[model samples]
Target: MQGKRVVVTGGTTGIGRAIVRSLASQGARVVTLGRDENALKDALDAMADLPGEVHGIAADLATREGVERLFAEADVRLGGVDALVSNAALGAEPIDEMADDDWRYVVEVNLVAAMAATRAALARLGKGGQIVIVGSISAEIHAPGESVYSATKAGLQGFAETLRKEVEERGLRVALVEPGTTGSDMQEASDDEQREEIAKARMLRAEDVAEAVDFILSRPPRVDVVTLRLEPRLQELP
Candidate 1:
């Protein structure tokens, strides 16, 4: 991964942070984006001692202007992008009970932003570049209270499938990594005990998902990893 130019979204915490750290630690030039300025500072501070180059950008992917700004900065900082990790997303409530704005926000962040980022990245990504979409196992299991989140993730899966074919002739690879019940702030545990329970054998750690992303990116140009699903040993579906 030495000197490889990479971009990561939602990279202040959770799985996104892990991916940033992993790539940067391996000597990749990494530019990560998040919505919070302070959080972005903290992320850059956390990587101060790393051997590779890592920069933090504050941008909200929900807006077209913000997305364009991110890509423009990437052009200036990284020269060209070799890999893009679309990891920014939020959990959502049931569709029927969710307000219209709430539904739109979730869709814009999870689905639309991913497509926008990929579209921009393609302009900078030459042959042998990679696009990794961080998805959720909820898309496959269809958990009852998370209809909106599941629907968006399912849409991402479809997007990745078609994108791989569209970009195949260009020597680009598009892959999806869907992790189940990861231990992160996004889990929204109610209390300390609940957090402990969720952190136990029932959940996959953020590093686990990061490792999946690293593996997909490390593959040679001739190989394309279509989809990877990661779940804890004891996790079960109903």
Candidate 2:
């Protein structure tokens, strides 16, 4: 893990932040990207004492322009990235209720942004480089009303599968880590029924997902842990 350079999108908060901290603690140089300037600053400040190098960049990831700016800065500062944890996603409204503006924003942020970031990182990633997409179980099973979010996550799952084949020859590894009910802010926007279902889980935490990432990345250079679907369930698979 010494001196590995990692890029984590959505790193100002939630699972993304946890991934940044874990990587930084493992002696990996980490660059965390988010749009919130204040939150980015807080993320940087919090990571200052880490043993590895830590930096933060604020860029709106929902647009092509924003992704371009992010990678340009990253090139100037990091030479190239060895790992990318693409976690930036917009969880949005029900299909019938979605405004056109909101629908566009959600798809652009949740799917396209991650693709652009992946393209940038893969451009320079050498052998042993890794990509982890922080996906959702929503990709596998859609709920009643989360059409936009579910569609984007399902798209991510498809993208990851194709990506693994495209990059494997170059020794680049890709994995989509789909987690069910992570203990994060995604549910704060949920209505009572949704929130109640999430609360019942013995739900997965951000760090739990981070550890799954750690496990994947820690594999030997020849090992690739692909398509991880982790859910916290002792009660039923029954």
Candidate 3:
């Protein structure tokens, strides 16, 4: 990944932070986008000692303007992006109880922003460039109370497939990663006892997913790991 210019969204925490660290350690020039300024600073500080370079930009992906700002920042920070990771997303409550505003917010971040970013990245990416959509296993599991999240991820999967086909002719690669039950802040949102039990079981670590992203980015131009599913052995099915 030496000198590779990459952009990662929602990269201030959790799985996204791990990916930024891993790639930067291996000589990639990574630019991370997040909505929180403090978290962005923390992410950069955490990676200060890494071998490669990392830069952060604060942008809320829920709006088209924010997505545009992210790419604009990438242009100035990295010159041109060789790869993009659409990792920003928000989970939603059950459809029946979800407010209209909340539903729109989730879709805007998870689906609309992802598509918009991909389009913008394509304009800068040349042959051999790659795009990885950080999706979720919820798309397959379809657990109750997560209908909106599941729908977004499932839609993202379909989007990736069509995108791969359209961009293959340009030598641009597209891949999707589906991670199950990662040990992130999301887990902390649950009750303390439930969170403790899940942690004790050694749920999939953020680093685990980061390693997968690293592998995908390191592959040869001709190779594309279209869909990679990462799940902890101890994680139960929904």
Measured by TM-score, the strongest candidate is: 1
Backbone steric clashes in candidate 1, count? 0
Write down the lDDT of every candidate, Cα atoms only. Answer: 0.90, 0.84, 0.89
- Quality of model 2 by C-alpha lDDT: 0.84
Model 1, span 94-182: residue lDDT tens: 99999999999999999999999999999889989999999988889998898899999999999999999999999999999999888
Candidate with better lDDT, 2 vs 3:
3
Q: Between which residue pairs do clashes occur in model 1?
A: none
Question: How would you encode candidate 3's per-residue C-alpha lDDT over 1-238 as one tens digit per residue?
Answer: 9999999998998889989999999999998889899999989998999998998888788778888888888899899999999998887888888889889789889998999999899999998999999999998998988889999999999999899999999989999999998877666455565557556764777888999999999998768899999887776776
> Candidates 1 and 3: which is better by lDDT?
1
| TM-scores for all predictions | 0.96, 0.91, 0.94
Among all windows of 10 consecutive residues in model 1, the one with the lowest summed lDDT is 190-199
Runs with alpha carbons beyond 4 Å of true place in candidate 2: 189-201, 234-238
lDDT of predicted model 1: 0.90
Residue 227 error, candidate 3, Å: 0.6
* Candidate 2 structure quality by residue, lDDT tens digits, 1-238: 7788888899888888888899889998887788889889988899999998888778889878787777776677677888888998877889779889989888999999999999988887988899999888888778767889999999999999999999999989998899887766565634555445556764676788899988887889878888888887732231
